[model samples]
Target: MTGAPRIALITGATQGLGLALAEGLAQRLAPDDTVYLTGRDLDRVNHAVESLPGGGARVRGELLDVADPHAAGRLAGRLAARHGGVDVVFGNAVMRVGPDDDPREIVTEYAEVNNFGTTRLLRAFAPLLRDGGRLVVVASSLGTLHYLAPILHDRFDGATSLDEVDAQVAAWRDAVADGSARGGPWPGFVNIPSKIGQVAAVRAFARERRGHDLAHGVLVAAVCPGMMNTPTSAEWWDVRGAPGPAEAAVPLLDLALGPVDPLHYGRLVRNGKVLPWSPYRDDSA
Candidate 1:
């Protein structure tokens, strides 16, 4: 709190992957660096921040629920006002439609939080980010590819063509319209394509905003994080089912807080490297 430290703001830092990532940064940050841990539960977030590596990492706790009804923009604005500029902001909370929820309700709420919530968070902080500042989002590989379910949970990838996924979405709408939306999880194949579409939208959002000569360019990429055992999945961490579930956080941290390069902007990356997806830098791919 003395010297102006480098700042990183992370949502969903109360537990699981978010906590792990925060810990990693705490271990590495210099005295002047501050980590802003945000979440819906104040007590939980405070505990998480307190429990972090206390060596000298100046940890600050901020409470925010990105999925709260119409609150994301306001929340982001508050962060911008408080910090002046965030060196890194990681959007990582999640809301998914599942068998326990109405299918239509699920998609609507999920999109609101995952897509719209993420967009608003970034836009709110655009002014607060220094030139060359970074933004990282926690996305599932399911948000990119149609992988088989591990008998523990379900998810979708959003990297494929929107047309194909749109067909499924239309069908889901039809089913829900007739009051026949099935109770089972949406098929993996169907979900992956839809998720990819969402990711694509995020990328486009970055592109449109790039026209402005903002501080440090934005690297708005989502990651799979490989279904680790976290609250989002109800703490279901069967290695066979949620294999490498928390493994993606380290790479996610790197993508957000590590050095920036000209090649990785708006790219969907994992494992400390930007994937060749979306032709982010592959001109002829």
Candidate 2:
């Protein structure tokens, strides 16, 4: 891996969109560039690496459970020591809880894996990024600030700090615990809040990167694939006729492989376009 042209780390690459992105990257990989693919299961991770486009010879697999922050830090440390650093870090792993589950359990699971776990990876891997690096977060269209409850919209819109974001997340967890989240606008929507928190995290990362000299030239942004047909949403995709993982990977590939545009920094992108956050753009119905 020494003297590689470029290095990239992609999590949750065992299946679905993560696998698609890995394949896409592999198809266009420069001879010296290397892409690290990670997943919870070692067998699955190795299989994914082998199955990637162009034989995936350049892809390396690692075991990673995003929910384990300590392990994530260790992985980051290893990457730092091995390659000296990386140029891109993609946060693609996610977990969701349905409305039928206990409210507290649903909120807790989603917050832990999606929100807190993602935060941990971002924080741990950020210092390992070389100058002019990029961080691409796989977010969802439904996670936009526009889809948040009115009160939450106000709070998140005004959140200028990670502490504020954590406070708001804590409040939401409390509401779920006490049953107040049941009839609320985003009631039982496990992925919504988690995704929203991811978007907010992108903003926070971009803001904080500017203050740290080690993190200079690093750009943070999130992307939504526009309702792709994957294992998790087979029924919805069956009826909606949405594109499959291979096709949906195009826009995300553009974000993952292209040069960073200053205007798009810290923004949410969909269909290869930057999506503005406005209540008027709310189409969650």
Candidate 2, 1-285: lDDT as tens digits: 224567888888888888888877777667667789998899999888877666432788999888785878999988888888887788888874443566676677667677777777778887887776777888888767767767668666667766777677767877887788787765466677778888887776667665552236666778888887665686334635788888988888777667666656777888767777656553221
Q: Per-residue lDDT tens digits of candidate 1, residues 87-147?
A: 7777776664543565554565555556556656655665576766777777655553323
Which consecutive 10 residues in model 2 have the weakest lDDT in total?
276-285
How does model 2 score by TM-score? 0.87
Candidate 2 residue pairs in clash (backbone atoms < 3 Å)? none
Q: All candidates' lDDT scores?
A: 0.60, 0.75
